[model samples]
Target: MERKSQIPRKTHILVISQYFYPETFRINDMASEWVKRGYKVTVLTGIPNYPMGKFFEGYGYRSRRKERWNGMEIIRIPLIPRGNSSVGMVANYLSFAVSGFIWKAMTDIRADLVFTFEVSPMTQALIGCWYKKKYHVPHYLYVTDLWPENVESVTGIHSKAVIYPIQKMVDYVYKNCDRIFTCSQSFIEPISQRGISKARIEFWPQYAEDFYRPVKKEDSLEKPKDEVLNLVFAGSVGYAQGLGILVEAAKILKSENRRVCFHIIGDGRYLPKLQESIKANNLEDSFNLIPRKPAEEIPKYLAWADALLITLSKSDVFSITIPAKTQSCMACGKPILVSADGEVQEIIREADAGLCSDAEDVCGFVDNIKSFMELSTDRRNELASNALHYSETHFNKERLLGRLDEIFKIGA
Candidate 1:
């Protein structure tokens, strides 16, 4: 008798994101892993320009629009980058939404499911829901930030007319998606209140890529000598980071002769203003503003630092938003200096990873830095150890990747 043959399941995934590989987004790693799991993954993204306004070298309309990356297909669409001005930022978002709409309407490729790696400008997910409606496929949305709330918090836009339309767009997207995955548990309430059923939304914490783990300090990166403590802040230099408070704290530390040097690694629109502030305050000696480092190279910077600093503007929305760098800091086995509120503070306190201060509180930030400096080497190591342990237990890469299978299976 001949035995019946079994066929492997087809898991064709279409990922909609404005950012992808070569950009330091967790979605890039997630897509690569899905490909390794035998799923055929295709990313629909804009050109590589991110954090920096200009297109990345060798990438433009003249360059290849479609390419293979780590066993997945990458299809680039046309969109204006977030250039220096507020008007330019709005144009960037609109450009992507329009171009993405055209591309989705014209593309013939079908998927068993659609996934959106929603960072900000929730407009990116608009295309995913569009695909779902057109193809009748399950749409899974991983919301890293909440819209309207995020908009108002980040941009200080409070006009009812401006917010009402955006709020409607957000609701429409959430209502259409089959599942909503939030990076923080706190996100569940806002999304639910937007009329999305609680059953449809689930808490899925962000995980650091494997490359983010602790590494031996590289000699190339400068580390302060003698008794000075190196406190590093790595990521965007945007207004929302509330780095002005850091500048204020630097002024105080300088006056008091506190041996703490702030190593700021990243760049953004706010950089020019920050540089001006540094010049005005004569903080050239206290602050080192380094350009953004590649994701793989960041662990070395973390290793060289005595502690890592994460800050945000004082806003209700920011309180619930956990900076993605938080996990990376913990994964690097470094003590954290968090000057934010809500979930971020809770994470630091629970993991015993580091200390926290109120956002934009210059005096509190100064005090915390001094406190970290005063902690014994053994105590600091203990905090670092706890941080690593927390990352292992709560954010193990493989464990988190394993969870994705269920999400993919939802509509398969």
Candidate 2:
């Protein structure tokens, strides 16, 4: 008698995110990594309109709707472009959620599990919930932003009338999801307060991409040929970033005749206001506002700097956030200059990676910058070494991805 062997089935994962590849998010790398690990991955995302508030050159509502990238399938749905206005942004989010429902009705894609990479608006998780209901699969939510709080922070709307409904929506999503993963440990209590059990929520911090590594200064094309102490801040320049403090700090540094230059890279809604502040203060020479560059090119800019700058606005929601850039900066082996609060400041202190100041503290931030400028070359090197070592031990990409794999297997 011959015995027949049973073959294992491939786990198909459906990822629901409003942003995806070509949008400069870590989810792109995660999806690719999953594909490399032999999981069948399909991404359901909207047209690529993000920090720029417009669609990418080649992507649109009517074109490039379905594509393949890095061995995974990408299905883009039609949504309103995110123009530079509050109404436009709201419309953009609603359009995606509405379109997602329509797409699910017409499509027959089935998956073993549903995963959502939630950043803002948080409404995208509804799509994953719908899929879970239809396919009887577990839905995992990776929450990068806390809703109702995030909405209040981004917009100035504090009315309970509006926030109550948003809070209800958030509660529904959290309740429906099988498991929830948060980027910061502080988020656990908040999620639990929403009637979710602590056991259902886990803290799964983000890891840096492989490309984010130490680059020799001499090899970096972006390196400035000067003796000035270069401090580089790379990421979105939104109001939540609290970059306005840099302008005031630059004025103080310039008055003291310090050879320090603040280099801010990236673009957002608040860029024009920041530029105007620089021009108004006549500190343009001390502050360099470079245009946004690709994520792959960020290491080169980091290598050019003596320290990496990280900041967030003074808000309860932001205080708990460990910005994704924190991992990126630590991975690059650069000394960090933090003007944020809570989790990020704690991480910097724990790693001894660099200096920290409370959010929007111009004097404290300036003092930290000056102190770094006064440090000996050996001390600077020590900070850099500490950063890289901490990243390897705490946020190694391989280890985190392996944990993710285990999570999926358990859920499946």
Q: Which prediction has the highest TM-score against the true structure?
A: 2
Q: Over 4 Å off in model 1, which ranges?
A: 1-9, 218-220
Candidate 1 lDDT by residue in tens digits, 172-280:
9998899999999999999999888899998899999888888777643566555778888999888888889878998899889887778899988788999999999
TM-score of each candidate structure, all chains considered together: 0.96, 0.97
Best of the candidates, lDDT: 2
Model 1 root-mean-square deviation: 1.8
- Residue ranges of candidate 2 with Cα displaced over 4 Å: 1-7
Clashing pairs in 2: none
Q: Rate the local accuracy (lDDT) of all candidates.
A: 0.88, 0.91
